[model samples]
Target: MELGVFLFRPLIRNRADFKQAEETLKKSEVWIRNIFKSLKEAVFVITPDRIFLDMNEAAQEMFGYTKEELVNRPSAIVHIDHEQYLEFGKKMEEVINKGEITNFQFKMRRKNGEIFPSEHTASLMVDNEGKPIGIVSVVRDLSEQKKIEEEKEKLQAQLQQAHKMEAIATLAGGIAHEFNNALTGVVGNIELLEMRLPDNKIVTEHTEAMKSSSHRMANLTSQLLAYARGGSYQAKTISLSDFVEETLPVIIPNIGPSIRIDTDLPRDIFKVNVDSAQMQMVLSAVVSNSSEALGGDGRIRVITSNEEIDAEFAKSQPGLRPGRYVCLTVEDDGEGMDEETVNKIFDPFYTTKFMGRGLGMAAAYGIIRNHGGWISVDSEQYKGTVVRIYLPAIEAEKKVKKEIITEPKLDIAEGEGTVLIIEDEEMVMNVTRAVLVRLGYHILEAKTGKEAIEIAKTFDGQIDLALLDIKLPDIQGDKVYPLIMKARPNLKVIVCSGYSIDTAQG
Candidate 1:
């Protein structure tokens, strides 16, 4: 009844037929053995009886079991949780019915009872009549792939930090230039008012009132400039509720009239080491940006919470360290951002505006980063955007003044001493001379650096001080300083310019 196969005996034909059948069976065994020898992943099989049937070199290495132990014993030394291994039986049954299967991801146990990620694929073997027999699996291991992905994300965070620093540098220069020029006008008017009228008179009283208004305008402009400057914060302990209440008035006006702002800041005495101005900048930009999104008709909600992040938890967050932080979140119901816009939002000069809406949140990115803080945004198009700012906190202590500082005002001397006021603009130079004359100091004014040297030579008396403009019509600050020093070697020089020291060099 047997055709080409009978376990121990050959086919019933002749002696040559018997020998040929034996040779064919021997060749097949050699082919399977050679294939298993070179495999890198664990390869083996289990019978329906749960006995160790056959295993390749990888399977033997993985299990730490010899061929003798595996050929007859159950594959239990590698898999400690032997009961859970029954799931493989269900997979095998499916493969047997299907004849072939695709690879699947799963966890597997090593010789040391360690479970790791792996994948396996199986095929059903059959007799010539196509009756199902057993399964053959090809296994693969996956630990190195996950490590590469983590490194890539860390590099991206560092790139984002560098971009934030560059944006602050650009914004600060522009703010200082414009705001200080405006302040010069303010202080110039106040100085003029003092000379024209005596104290306590009606004329002097009105002049003083105008001066107060100008100073208020100066203060408001300074606050907005600081928002553009980034990270210049006076950090101290303050009540969270009070901070919000104080910030709301300034921020609300920046938002649109159509937007209804809501707040839920706690009245409890929760204190943190935050720069009030820097925090205000963060709140203003985020809320204003949201209002801009809503087309002037929406609501914004601001909430604060105390959160502690352990080392394990912090590692999961992008660019965050393990510590205590006060989380302030701004939520707005508006037309939110898409994936492309959100990714590039923090980049300098990269804006959603068509031509020039200006640096809307470019400065906001710098302010938070400068505070050693973290900011993240979640947004969906036509839905909303939630911006979260995490700031480090410290314990608040009772305030105390250690000492008092009082610098005495020097009494003005009516001297015949010559003062050379070297400034680029005629308006600024004329104002400087007027202020000095009020103090009874005779003045020699020059509109350019070249003219300044000529005035010093023709001075009627000794040149006392040179109020040199760091920026000049003919020469730069550094160049002018040396020329003036060489000419009037011992002259007392007071460097006065609208630009900050950093900007003067720039």
Candidate 2:
């Protein structure tokens, strides 16, 4: 009787232990299920035969399917294609054989049939005996990540381009300044020669030819200065819409008749302070670029509107500020450029045409930038192109009508005065002295600002006018002006510079 009771006791103890073990297993399974559902990454369980066994909430959301719909179904439905599925399966099998996990990027399909990039991490699940049962995979959608990476790369490229353009602009400005100084000598000498040999027809012809060539070179230098952001000579606040309307007549003849132009210049547009001639050049260049894009027979729309740039939008674009802006949009239905070509369009000397100066768009870019404006371009292959130029706007009440004044050309009448010429370049100084001396003015020359200041202080003769070069080796012309004024308070001063008057003053 004691042995039988002990056997029953052992059976009762075993039953109690089994019940406790079953409850613990149930709790663990619930905990694991809760963790799986709470996961952000899509988790999936697949049978060894590549059939979907179960999936978490994230997985169902990611693939646009419910667990009940995908369970017991082939996993190929989520893959980009059957061939990709097979390849992925082979790779998974190879990794499992090596007792490793599979991780890779693969294109995946959503329920709506949209294909997208996805990162997949998969491993084999095993039973208690260590035999493979199914696959456990965690997938991450890489679409947003790829987009962010692409945006970062684009910003980096834009920064590099801005640096390159800045360097180029410095070089161009220096060259233009030096070239203008040299041209001053040439043009002055030619004028003196013309004055001396007025009666000689042959000499007049040669001198005129030289003058024409020099004038053309001067124009080229002006364009270079424009591209260097030193070209706005006379900036005035005016109605941009009116200015465009007046300038389009002159520009239309240049663009062939096949290219139709439509303008929507609303009179209510905000006014902008810009150099009229430079703005005209910008408009002409932008129109010409669009015209060239259209081999022939395409519509071009020029529209102007008031726009307000917000801080967030301004922050995304370099060198842009938040403000009320007047936007000029030029849209063209023509052969467009690819991304690579569009990137280089604003670079100096970059062009797609067989014959082009390539400075048109570059100068346009500089002119707008110099006027406190920004330019942007959008294009697609075979689709079209759109360009937007934004200039800071002023209140309409500040708009002023600029009057046109025509000045008749006057002959160089001889003058009697004592003139002081302060110039650094030897050729420019010599030619200027000769021209003044020829005009019956006594010349006092100084190659440096110090020399000029000394001449103003100690010179016994009455100094009538002082011609001061803005740029000097010893002291800048602006600084020298105040110092020399201390000595010669009554002397009249004329400021000269290779740069525009506005830039020179600043």
Candidate 3:
């Protein structure tokens, strides 16, 4: 059972037989070394006492060690941690005594002290009589395989998140659409009622309250659509100074006095082409976040500035072109966020506030993107947060000035030219017709798009205006619009929808 006897012994009866035995023994030793060296997987032999007995060329390359350096070294040299070395030694003893061990995972350190994942299988090396002598292990590096697995997991998570956001957006859009239609009806009816009770102070006060409530409800619906619609926006040239001024009064009262507000609007007007309504929602969302971060006590500074992004600057933002932009920055002196929190702030349903639907930041992001603009957020744990919105700017000559006009009193009960009202919702149509009727216009009504087209064609084309709803039973109100236009091309048509302009497009 001895190692020397088991490998070198041969039957010999003469001098020639002795010489042949000696040659055969040398050849067998060469063949064994060659077989081990030719293996693709790293192969090494360790003694029962945990010493490195022998290793092949593949093993040398794998561990960045020479055969002379590894031959008598402790088997623990390949493992980084002392605890791991002791653990592997115990496992190796089991492999030497009990047959074999398969697929044992371990972290191995290379010559440069870099650690990588590996899997190894070991079997007992035995003598001619089957007594165990040493352990032979085959090791395979799993670094590349592990990387692939991790990347696949990351991609899977991203796909799942995208699907979830899309589902929520669709739901929000539907709810907003229905709610806006109902609000339109309620508000229209309340106005008509107020007109009838102008002289009655008691009734007028009640109607005023109802009108304010409906207006608030309409604002809520607008925010819902801002979060949901994944399409283009309706952009108009508007003065940024005027917009901020108009929003402050509404913002100041609701945010309370605990939060002090500061503004830095330039004397020279900055004009950006964007949707005013969506931008208002964006500002509301940004300020709401600031107030929440403040927890009812902090300062907010809103500043408007002109920005020119050159090619070098644009390189920082992929897909952005060099251009002039109007920057609206909102800075808050409140509880800020860490890197992890900031990364997920714009993701739908992500929130830190106690009272929130988790859609404020997400809606702000969507609205800005839809307006063909860019938004960036900078924050530190206690230093506070700054959110910057960059919108495309119009030329000086293209700037639009909004003039406030005071309307003189008009007689509310006088007859005028015939007007067409096309709406699918009965309640909405009825309330809208009554309001127009009270405004001294003869009303022509249709509960469906087809009925409206018939009415427009048969009439003498004297219709002053067409109040049309985009959604209809048989056809889209937009499609009906063109057909009605055939009868009266010069008709002043107004299309109404509860949904976003993109979703409502026929």
Candidate 4:
């Protein structure tokens, strides 16, 4: 017997000892073989020529090929039987000849033509002399695992979609609530005026209130559209310094009487290529929050500087990198927040204010992100709050003065034959006519759709250009425009709408 050929954890005593060792080796081999046979995994051996030499009982049961039919057959013959690809089989042969061990995953067919995914662990077999002989492969089906992975990814995407919808729904509700309150004030004022004012005197106050409220409505709609991530705007170079200075007075008053605003913006407009409207939004939301942080009586400082934020600086901030940027810092000595509260500042509907609901800062984050910029905030309770906005910088470009549009002057026909201006709002009509009258254009006025139309048909001879408002009582201006256009075909028509142009188009 070769030394160490069979291992027995005991002392050998002559030829009898050698015979006992041989019996022990035989018993161990039977035990290992029985264990292999019990496993459901299919086991097979392939000769160097890629021909199958043996298939375990499990393999035979799985492939529906008997030992007689499979042994001595070239591995390629099983291509149809096992649904293995020819290219993969060839690759396996190449790997075997190269004496490399490998594990493979593939789909193989059964006798019934049903394909199932499988994972295989295979290595070249060798004799006791370490000479290469054939290949042994242990294969297990992986169809179940693949199914689980696909289902997990599908569920993940669905969850993401659901989260997005829920966020948008919350934002919509916030905007709607604010808008309803504003509209109620405007509508109530107009309704009160309708009861007291005489037809001629109706052109006094509520109309201007209506116009102001209409513009506010437009502004609100614009913000909601941005939060909704819809609409596109043309990008252009804008001077931040000048824009901020102009917005200072407007934002300052909104902060209330308790706050003192000090601005440190450079005189030069730090120019950037972005939509001006969106930038205004970013400025407004941040400044408003800073103001609120002060709780009505504190000082706020807006400082702008040229900064180069490098990778190291960005690492501390997260999601930022080294770049030449313009930093706009809004700092306020007010009631500040903790670190945990700040991290979630950009999540929609996350707010510290009891009355505040929509995460307006989230809108600011999205806006800055879209502008190829980043925002970071630092704060501590009662110390102060500071928000730093890092925006990429561009080389200063030559400025081209924009051509201001001058309207063509209208030649007025000399005749004050009661040029009735049919508009529902009295103040807007009165103010407009006052301006036109100052310019020598005769003005006549009606306050509603029914009254305006009645005045138009009653006035005899060239009624002149009727300055018409599209929105009115009893009927829409759009419905009135066509009737006025058709009945008074010869009358010059000028259309006016407080908010939407659609009224006149109709």
Candidate 5:
């Protein structure tokens, strides 16, 4: 009886151990199944022949199919095409040999026939003997990631372009300033020479030629100054639609008779504060660009509309702020530009046309930016190009007064008062002195701000007018103005500079 009891005890202990092992195995299976289903990324289990064995909820949602529908079906149904499936099969052989494949990017198709970019990391599932039995893969959709990367690159490009344009504007402003000073001397000297020279046809012809050449050079400098944002002489709040209507006739002849011009200037369009001349130049540049793009016969549409830029929209466009704006759209149905060409269109000296100076668009860009606006261009090869200029809109109720016009006298008035000329440039000073002396005004000269103040203090004669150059050697002209005013309380003053009034004040 005792021997039988001991044997039974050993049997019972063995049965208990076997039961415990079975329960542990069940727990592990549940754990693994839960992990597979709970994964955020799409997971797939396939047979050696690439038949779908099992899939998680994420996989079903990713492929737009139910688990029961995809099970036992060929995995090729989820691939972009049959050829891509075959290519994937070839890659599976490498996976089998290497024990796994990681980060294999490819295009995938959904049940509704939509193809999107995807990346999958697959591992070889093995049997007890380590023989490849199937594949288990985790997949991630790359469409959003790719989109984010593209946006980042685009923003980087825009930032780079802004920096480049800023540098160019600084250089251009400096050049225009110096060039305008030199031109002042040339133009002033020419005026002096014309007055002094006796009547001779040959001399008159040569001087006129020089004057014409100088004027052309001055025009070129003006364009550079426009590109540098220093060309805005006067700003007025005006209806954009009315301005466009008034200017289109002048632009039409230059566009040529071959091309047709269409305009949709709505009466209720918003008003903007801008220099009329500079705004006209912007329109001309844009229209001329479209005309040149047409190359002979095509339609150019000029349209005006009100736009509201929200914060999200403004975030995508560099240097743009969210606000109400008036949009001027110029669209052309002609030979368009490629992505590369469009990217460089606003760069100074960049052009597609033969012998083109390429300053028009660049100057237009600067003008709009200086007016607290922006320009956007969209183009595709052989399709069409659309340029949108956005200017800040003012309240509709604000009254815009019409500018008064008067005819010019056409003659330089002879001056009788004593003039104080404060200039740093020698050529400018000499020509200016010659002009004032010729005009019958007694002149007092000073090359620096300190010298000008000293002359204002000690000069015995009454200094009636002080022509102050904004840029001076020692102190700024604005600073010197108050000091000289303190010294000569009754003196009148005029501020002169190549920069815009806003810039000079700044």
Candidate 6:
């Protein structure tokens, strides 16, 4: 009887323990379900037949469907492409056979027919006995991620473009330097030749041609300097409407008779502080480009308007600022450019026309940028082109008359001085010396900065002025100037360069 009682008590204890264990397991399952529901990622439980069994709140929100609409629905509802749907089925089979598959990317459709990129992971759901129940998938929206990636790529491309422009600017600077040195010799010699030649019509005509050619070369060098961001100019307050009016006589004849010219300016002209010469260059480049676009058949319109750009608008432009601007626009009804051509219009040496120098628009762009302004080009293939220039506006202030103070013209016989010429180029040095000699000044020459200092120190006579070239093989001309100054304290110094002297370089 005692043995039977002991066996019955042991059986009772085992049954009670099993019941507690079963209750704990049910609580754990409830907790796990709550955890799945709380997840930010969409969790979907799909049957082997691709029917939706259950889903979390995220899954409902992601598909734009409520729990009632999604349950028992075919998983094909979220797949926009039919082939993608078939691919999903194969992936499900893979997950079931291989235990799990992760980071499967696909396009998903919402209930509203909106589609978005998504990435998801799937694993086989099973019962305690290891029998397959359904497939559990955790899906993540990749739309924002893809957008970030695309933006990153665009920024990288812009950086590469900036680097390329920098390289081009360096090359342009070197070319301008060399070209300017050559022009100095050509122009100086031509002027000397003109002074010596007799006043015959034929002789004067040929010399004038030489002068014209030299002037054109000078203009070309100036444009290259502009492209290199080394072109120098003085900015002053100017009225845009007045400037255009004054420039019309110069511009009209060059545009040809077939192309009609029109103007639309405000009664009160927009005022901007800018370099008049550079501004003129900008206008000329735009009009010339328009004339070519028209092929001597269409109309060119010059329009001016006031504008105020906000930060939001300026954000799209890389170097633009938020402020009031005088918007000067030049539009033409000519053969316009395609997108590819328009994209490269501002690049130096890039041209669409057969006879173009390719520096017009590039110089215009650089000049505007140097003046703290922006230039935009818009064109449509076979339609037309519109070039817009935005310059900062200034408040109404006293119009100061720019005083034109000219140097007193000195006769070659009256001129008297001992001038020092420091230059590296032999032709430029010789021509410069001849000009001074003709002006009745004694010349002291040096081919380099070191040689110039040595000559200045040893010279016993009065050194009236020093014409120093900015570029030297031994040292920068600015650095050498102080040494020369120390040697000759009372001497006047004229620093010269073939290129523009920017403030930093000056």
Model 3 misplaced regions, further than 4 Å: 1-41, 48-51, 54-101, 111-113, 230-232, 236-350, 353-358, 368-415, 501-506
Q: Give the per-residue lDDT digits (tens) of candidate 4, residues 1-506.
A: 21122222345679998898778867776776676578788987776677787767898887778889888887664454544556657656766667777787777777677778878787776555555567777888788898988777755644554366347745654564345334544654554454346474546565766768767776665455445443234457666677678778766666679788888888653566666767777888888888888777888888888787777666445445576677889998887888667756666668686216664776677666556677877889778889988777655323212211223344444445445577766666655565456446667777877776776667665666777765577887767777776767777656544332211221
Number of backbone collisions per candidate, in order? 0, 0, 0, 4, 0, 0
Off by over 4 Å in 6: 1-29, 48-50, 83-97, 111-115, 126-133, 199-207, 239-272, 284-343, 352-357, 373-414, 453-458, 481-493, 501-506
**Best model per TM-score:** 2
Clashing pairs in 6: none
lDDT of 6 by residue, 296-331 (tens): 788999998888888976755556778778889999
Model 2, C-alpha of 403: deviation from truth (Å): 21
Clashes of 4: 4
TM-score for each model: 0.50, 0.88, 0.68, 0.38, 0.87, 0.74
Local distance difference test values of all predictions, in order: 0.65, 0.81, 0.76, 0.65, 0.82, 0.79
> Which regions of candidate 2 deviate over 4 angstroms?
1-24, 396-413, 501-506
Of 1 and 2, the candidate ranking higher by lDDT: 2
**Candidate order, lDDT descending:** 5, 2, 6, 3, 4, 1
Model 1 Cα lDDT, one tens digit per residue, 1-506: 11113112334488888688778866765665676677887876655444566778887776566667777566455453666466666676678667777467667777567776667777655555666544567777665665666666755664664555455555664665566666676577667776766564877777778878877765544443443442134566676667878888987877679889888787653466656766776677777788887877989998887767688756655556777677778898888989777776665456675212544465566556555567777898888899887766553213211111122333345666677788876667667778778878878777787787766656566787777776787877557766777767777666556543221110
- The digit string of per-residue lDDT tens for model 3 on 1-506 reads 22233345677789998898878877876776677789989988877777888888898898999989888889888998889999888788788667767559899999879899999898777765677777778999899999988777755654554466567778878788788878888888788777887899998889989988888887677667777763335567687877998898887877858899999988576688777777887898889888888888989999998888788766555434577788899999887988777767777667675226656777887677556567778899899999998877776224322221222333335568777888878888788778877877888988888898898889864887777777888888769888988877877666667864332111
Q: What is the lDDT of residue 410 in candidate 5?
A: 32
In order of TM-score, best first, we have 2, 5, 6, 3, 1, 4
Show where candidate 5 strays beyond 4 Å. Answer: 1-27, 81-87, 353-355, 396-412, 500-506
Query: What is the lDDT, from 0 to 100, of the residue 96 in candidate 4?
Result: 65
Best by lDDT: 5
